[model samples]
Target chain A: MTDIRADIHAQTGASEPGFGDYVTLLKPRVMSLVVFTALVGLLVAPVALHPIEALAAVIFIALGAGASGALNMWWDADIDQVMRRTARRPIPAGKVEPGEALGLGLALSGIAVIMLGLATNLLAAGLLAFTIFFYAVIYSMWLKRATPQNIVIGGAAGAFPPMIGWAAVTGSVGIEAWLMFALIFMWTPPHFWALALFMKEDYSNARVPMLTVTHGRRSTRRHILAYTVLLVPVALAAGFTSIGGPVYLAAALVMNALFLHGAWAIWRRDEARAEADGYRTEKQVFRLSLYYLFVHFSALLVEAALRGTGAYALVGIAG
Target chain B: MSTRTTPLRPTHELHKRRFSRNLGVGLTLVAFIALVFGLTIAKVQGGGTLQAYDHTFRPALLPQDD
Candidate 1:
């Protein structure tokens, strides 16, 4: 730990972070996903919101996601420096100080929660607060290092966006909201496990108990296949909900077929074969997983748009 | 006898630029907070009249009343 601190000090001696570095600290990619899912939740809700209120709700939810990202980076600075993929992140790369990251995160968290409550409702704001705390304190600080089930339970933090968005509009959670949450929650393990398979050494070096590090690659592969199988039902079931439509069902069928095929391909590959191919199948599955979630949500958005235009009325499935 | 030369100091212009940047950031944050507060108040008091502020900042897609 001392060596890590010394390494950080050496790298950051006189470095001055640019505005972009501060933005990087917020994990913009993760924030984008959060914002998109939350927006879908808000738009798909049965209730109506004024344009300004919807916009404000999305913005505050985004800020809360950013705050969680910053706090995660701050808490995981040590392991971050060890991981090859994360070594160049703001704090680890010495672009931003840990203290600055913490302060920014705390400030953003407070602002997002307060403003969300004012803009939407107390339920949404409260959920946003819990999401931040769960990600930062529970997942990042505790679960991440403690168990192989880290991503399993920690996935809840990422799963809350749509629920919060639903709450923003309806001031309560519903089955559809939980279904959206469930889709992401189920997707996280296989998605992360694929990355972990390829980046085994990083988790090993960081001593983080990612399933890959603890249970070995063979078990991780089985887990990936299992979770992907489990995820299919959730993903398919969502397409039958009020938010679901022909577009969503079509997309779900095609995407789930490809997703399952990819998972099965990984499940069949031995460690030696994976190593021989540089974990290509695992990496492909991981990439597909990203599109899988995005397309699912996008299909929901399309369903909502179709309903907006009375197109679903033709099919008589307009709820 | 000390023989090491001291490093050149940053120029006054650099200091001024830094100060100005800091001031800009500070002001931006303050303005943003004020905007959020003002909008929240207007939202609570005005009910569904968010369209009134549309001229100031219009959303790309407006929600329609059914």
Candidate 2:
């Protein structure tokens, strides 16, 4: 049977996709970040939720984010086929059909939104619905192919999860929630542009009009430095909010310094020198950007857990 | 002599894929049902409010700490 199946596969040259292939269509790595940030947002809020309710909220939020990812892959299958990075996605790799992806995305979007409304509150569900629309229709279908400022504007979709999580618990938006939103919003440019710096050809070949492609690498480096300079203050400002404390402030200070220094190094290096060193500084900054967000969010969680305890005492601004 | 060349039903990769998809859907459905049940229980356990509009003092609406 194995021999026969091997011959069948060799003859057909078709991918025998399994259930996992469909799961991959959801962009699980990105969904994990959505889950993490949403969970942190829910946990940090003043209102407490039943564990069951919180679990349901986080799961539905993850589902909503995954559905948007499926919609993005469905819409971008053409460009996914072009770029080496996304070329192996389920749709482009021939493991899934475009129409199937679209149907699944739409169906899951509906289910997630309605179920979240039932599980949490309408405000959270409404935010999730808008996020899906923003990512699928606004960003994926329109801005991604049309503008160089694509990520600049489109970063809102990724920034909204924590806000949704906050609304889920409190049935409203608050300043602390927006502070988390701003953290991700500002961090996105430097993070993605860093990836684009190293992966320039991929975006250019796909004609995605990324900053690195449209504005040129030198300008891209300058933008990275500018955004990093801008990001530092936004990150530090969170420490003054009700959710902030010594731990969060300390994490924000150290991470922002490292991030800003890396951006400065990237800005100082010339194309000739960057090429000589194989874009090491750009790549390092890209890797650091991941940890930078992780550390900030983790610090928020720590501060929330420490609330009302002696250890939670003396937040610089909260006090 | 038994006339058997291929098995009655030859195993195929498509069958495996189909089985996995069906299993995933089935498990997900079960999980969804369980969640709805759990959510309902949690909501009920949270204690219902006295009809705010009616303002009738329903003893049942109050927490049973006494």
Candidate 3:
């Protein structure tokens, strides 16, 4: 079916990108994060879905995430063309047309939401739909270019996967779900700000009003530290919830301590000093931030395992 | 002076490179389709896999006194 006309590149003055390029547009790495977090949500929820149903829910959630990624790429292709880091992305690189990405995103969004509903419940599906629109339309199209707080408000989109996962099983949200949401929501500013610290030039050149670009690296650093303080408490609190056990609590305590130390180091460094030090502190924090969510969720799984073996009793025994 | 010709050389090299690339693409595409299919089928068949945590901690496990 990949005939000449089906290519759609020659007539549009665009190049025919390979399959890999289209996959790249989906932001598989980000989707992986979504899948993991949503898995945690589903697992930690009060109810237990069937094994196959749980897997299907996570897959649909991931598809929703990928759909959001495609739409974000489509909308941001213009700005992406101007940013050095993003210039090589499929849509901006002319490997994939923006329209193709848009269509793929819309199709996946519908499929994911519908399938999630069929497999699970309306609440989970509705939440997934909201997450897609929040990321694609509200966050990417409107907030990203309009304000420095874009990531702050838009962080909700990334935070929704776990909630959606929880709802998939329990068919509702509770404090635990929101706690998971808070953990990611608070973590986002500092996580992306660390990248902004090093990639400020890219944002500036692209004319995107990132906090670092608009308010200066110093202000961004301050914000990172502040958010880190907020995140640590929220993340640690999640450890005390019904889903949490000794394993998760210990992990959260240690991980959050390390995260704070790293954030502090970033705040203390002068730009030139940081440059000379190769931004190692920020880079390390960024890497750890990636692991932070995964480890926390995995620790919850550990808690579940313990509960299974009758090793540890539920802490709250309520909620 | 240089009359030696390895008869299988060109075909062997072509096959090696082509096979690897084809294998890579084929594996990736299959994995993607399988993931989607597995999820869809799982959804249709029985809802979803129990989360590791869920299987470990069932609702029945709650204290009977409550």
**Which CAPRI quality tier does the interface of model 3 achieve?**
incorrect
lDDT scores of the candidates, listed in order: 0.89, 0.91, 0.85
Ranking by lDDT: 2, 1, 3
Clashing residue pairs in candidate 1 are none
Per residue, candidate 3 scores C-alpha lDDT tens digits across A1-319 of 2344333334544454556676788899999899989998888777798786788889889999999999999999889999998899988788787899999899889989998998789999999999999999999989999999999999999999999999999998999999999999999999999999987589998889999989998998899999999898899888778888678889999899989998998888889988897888889999988888788889988877677656553454333
Per-model root-mean-square deviation over C-alphas: 7.3, 4.0, 8.1
- Write the residue-wise lDDT of candidate 3 on B1-66 in tens digits: 565543434344334445654776799669767766766666445423333433443555454784
Which portions of model 2 show Cα errors greater than 4 Å?
A1-16, A308-310, A313-319, B1-4, B8-11, B50-66
Interface CA RMSD, all predictions: 9.5, 4.9, 11.2
Per-residue lDDT of A191-307 in model 1, one digit per residue for the tens? 999999998799999999989889888999999999999999999998888888789999999999999999999999999999899989999999999999999999999989899
Model 2 DockQ reads 0.40
Per lDDT, the best of the predicted structures is: 2
Best by TM-score: 2
Q: What's the CA error at residue A318 for candidate 2, in Å?
A: 6.1
Rank candidates, DockQ, best first.
2, 1, 3
Clashing pairs in 2: none
In candidate 2, residue A234 scores what lDDT?
92
TM-score of chain B of 1: 0.54
lDDT of 2 by residue, A87-127 (tens): 99999999898998999899999999999999999999999
